[model samples]
Target: MVQEEKIPSHVAIIMDGNGRWAKKRGLPRIFGHRAGVKAVEKIVSHAANIGIKYLSLFAFSTENWLRPKDEVSGLMMLLSEFVDKKFFEIIEKDIKFVVSGRLIDLPDEPRSKVLKLIETSKNNTGMVLNLALNYGGRKEIVDAVNKILASDIKDIDEKVFSGFLYSPEVPDIDLLIRTSGEMRISNFMLWRLAYAELYFTKTLWPDFDEAEFDKAIFDYQNRDRRFGMTDEQIRRGNI
Candidate 1:
């Protein structure tokens, strides 16, 4: 069971392995993507119900654009449909819908829908659902730097630089969950995941459920997040 007091403020997930899951079941990859969307709906609702402040999902990466045209088109269509269907539900649940990427890169219809969702939910006082669509961790850093260079500021630190991120309102990730047995971050959130507890599951994204989420939370609670402190210092509450 997850300890309510210790619930992570921000949880980021690298939803992976839709292709492999589809292959295993002798179905098209799009089928797996569709199933993954169902799992996303379940997780988003559960996260909000569990008092998570921010939930960041790696929905689409900038690199993902290199995929076959048909798959990409299907994904775009699916995304548009999802936004259309979930707009009302997001409002009803008081969830803030936000995107953390180059929104202009999206197709016209989906981009319009995404913008509408963000505008509509901007004032929601509930959990933030941050979708990393067409996002790249390295690109984010580069863009931040470019913005800094364009400014007149001569010097800055990490804290100051963070304000230039795509979703600066969202805090650093507390726990990062990667599914499909992946052992890597895959350029998800390089800056924000600096000290996050990593939880990797072999379960495919389509199969990840509330139980799996709880298991990850349970594992996080058991670990000692000493950061850079020694074990003795942690024991002495010298954090």
Candidate 2:
């Protein structure tokens, strides 16, 4: 039997279409958000099982604050519930939970819960599951720059600035998947995805499952990631 191809070191996702999925079903948008959480649980477990070292999910964006208050509150509530319900299972699985993006804007309770969860899972040896909450790509880059400027180093290189970002140890994204037919990155991991392969699907987040994920991986495996080198050079160099 053929062995499965080596799993990607890191994978990022733009979990879009929750609101649209809800509207299509004539249900409250929060319902879609709630269902999306189930998808998160399934995908994370499968990712870990399949040997994906790092998984990043765009859970909340900085611009998400503009959404309806009820929806935002519901999202936070779901986050709390997820933490309360999954912390032990996550620890048992040895999956490390990490949060990216701004923390100051998050309400005290949710912020505290996130901190507790991260602390509890910090030493886990399994996949690193990163939740991008209150996250924006441009804002993250700006924050990294500001942090670099504040440091003692006079000259800043890309490597130096990158080390200041939220989680410097995480590898650059290898594949970024966006569900709901979205074709854009939507300010999710702008710097980190500089060389990442992107996959867009019309399947809504609620409907996205292991099969869809496998398709994305299959597509990624077929890509010619030459980066900047010529095809002939890559062919000879065994990239």
Q: Residues 100-131, candidate 1: write the lDDT tens digits.
A: 99888999998999999999999999999999
Q: What are the models' TM-scores?
A: 0.98, 0.96
Count backbone overlaps in model 2.
0
Give the per-residue lDDT of model 2 (tens digit) for 21-119.
999999999999998999999999988988899999999999999988988999999999899889899999999999889988998888999899899
Candidate number of the best TM-score: 1
lDDT values, one for every candidate: 0.95, 0.90
What local lDDT score does residue 105 receive in model 2, on the 0 to 100 scale? 91
> Candidate 2: misplaced stretches above 4 Å?
1-3
Clash pairs detected, candidate 2 = none
Error of 1 at 183 (Å): 0.7
